[model samples]
Target: MTVPVVYSACEAYPTVRFVIATQPVASSLFVNPPQNLTVVGVDVKQRYKGTHGIWRLMGDLRREYAIDAFIDLHDVIRTHIMGVYCRMHGIPMSRIDKGRSEKRELTRETGKNLHPLISTRQRYFDAFKRMGFDFGETFTSVYPTGADTTLFADITKPKSGGERWIAIAPFAKHEGKIYPPGLMSLVVDTLSQRAGTRLFLFGGGGYERDILEEWACEHPHNVTSLAGKRYGFAKELALLSHCDVMLSMDSANMHLASLVELPVVSVWGATHPYCGFTGWHQNPANEVQTDLPCRPCSVFGNKPCQRGDYACLRGIDYHAIVQRLDNVINQR
Candidate 1:
């Protein structure tokens, strides 16, 4: 989505080139990206380690691209340090407005505010706008041409008859945001019984694999687990393009599904969509959540529930998720 957001700036100023500085691992997500845009793979863990590293990065950027302006969407302590380097170089720059105060109101334990905050993308657009590179809506995050289909050919087969494919991402980095594994398995078991539907379990290559694989084995004919697969990001993206709808927690998978312009039925827990983390152009109606006063107890779902039990998550019945999935599948 950052590529698309910045690509709009490239459109407005045809002479301009964009240096999309990202973590080394994530650079693979872009395949044959725009000619005007250069994706710089930065290793914050290795190459750019401290203040000295940031200074080196600044020098490299100047020497490599002779770039005049900087827009920092990643408003972290590290990026702030990098912005200082940009200032020292006499470069014009704009950092993102994270709307921390607005986010606070939404996540507070007492007298919670339910109004939506300005979206992260809107802030990105605004940051570029501050640099006088005004642009319109972002482009879809679809893969560029020349993707290798063979990567998924052996692992994934064509849908038989009027079959519909559903991708279920049942894990989040913070357990507070994810539905319980046992309950999610129940959701999978129920969905597997649906006539003309096939389930695909998605997760990172870790302990998440064990849980996802267990659910997949139970419905061997109808389910497949993509966790810890050797296939790269581009291929995983290509596979997601074929899913009818992504059933996900408010996590990266939901955002990834949106990148391919796929419909997502996202389940919300401690993190509310109102906090501006909703997937790109996803319908608010598709958000499945139990409405409680303390609904959005945390912003990123990293904080523990003050109520002792995480009723916000554990209280969500398995049937509710399945029913919502049924509606999303039929409506789409």
Candidate 2:
């Protein structure tokens, strides 16, 4: 989600050399960043273990990169410690206003204030503005010319003239956000039956690979499973740019597709778009979710369903999801 925002910042302040520190797992997404941007993969849990470790990490970053002012996008404890280090050194700093109270109101069980809050991307832009940096949204696609399509040539073939390519990311980190497998299989079955329609299933892990493989086997000619293929995010982005639409949960895949300006048909379960985690430049009309009062019970969809039935997800008609995809594909 922060990928495009940081990229925009880099473009806005061309004179400033921006250094981004993120988890190692996410570093792959920063492969071909702007010239002014440098990404450093930080193993926070392994290397920066304690307050002292974070303090030391700050010093290392400062000395190594000639640090000046600090803009803390993540206001977690580690970033708080980093702010302290900067203040102690007389380095100016600013942090994001996470809108904690507003988010609480949006997610609370009773009297929920469900209007959309400020977007996470907007919050990031505001943070930079508070630090006296000015910029507009100049980002378009990571692969301006388009991603190197040759990377996955083995599995993906050139799109035919009438082919409607669709990508489906059926898994999220939490169970609350996942569409029921039996229903998802029905979706795959229905979509693959259409003439000149190609379905690509995206995921990772052996369990996900097993499921995707089974689905691909069911629709041998139309469905291709990319799970556990070991192709990095760059390659995935390459493939995504060619797709007409992506079907995903409230997960990273939605944002990844957004980076390339691909339309997304996102499924929301325990988490709602009102939490301000919607994909960058995505249309709210394309979001497939039910209007249950207990919707958005968790901010990240990590919490167990309070009602023990996950009615918020189950109540959503799979046919509505298919229709949403149809609209997106036909419109394109």
lDDT of 2 by residue, 1-332 (tens): 77888888898888899988878888889857999998988887777778987987898899899899999999999999999999999999999998999988888888888888898999999999998997888887888777666855776877889889999999999999999888898899999999999999999978999999999999999999999997888888888999999999999999999989999999999999989999989999999998888877888888889899988888888899999999998888
Return the clash pairs for model 1, or none: none
Q: For model 1, how does the per-residue alpha-carbon lDDT over 98-169 read when each residue is reduced to its tens digit? A: 999989988998988788888887888999989988878656666644335565786787656688889999
Question: Which candidate achieves the best TM-score against the true structure?
Answer: 2
How does candidate 1 score on lDDT?
0.82
TM-score of 2: 0.96
Per-candidate TM equals 0.94, 0.96
Off by over 4 Å in 2: none
Q: What does the lDDT read for residue 82 in candidate 1?
A: 80
lDDT of each: 0.82, 0.90
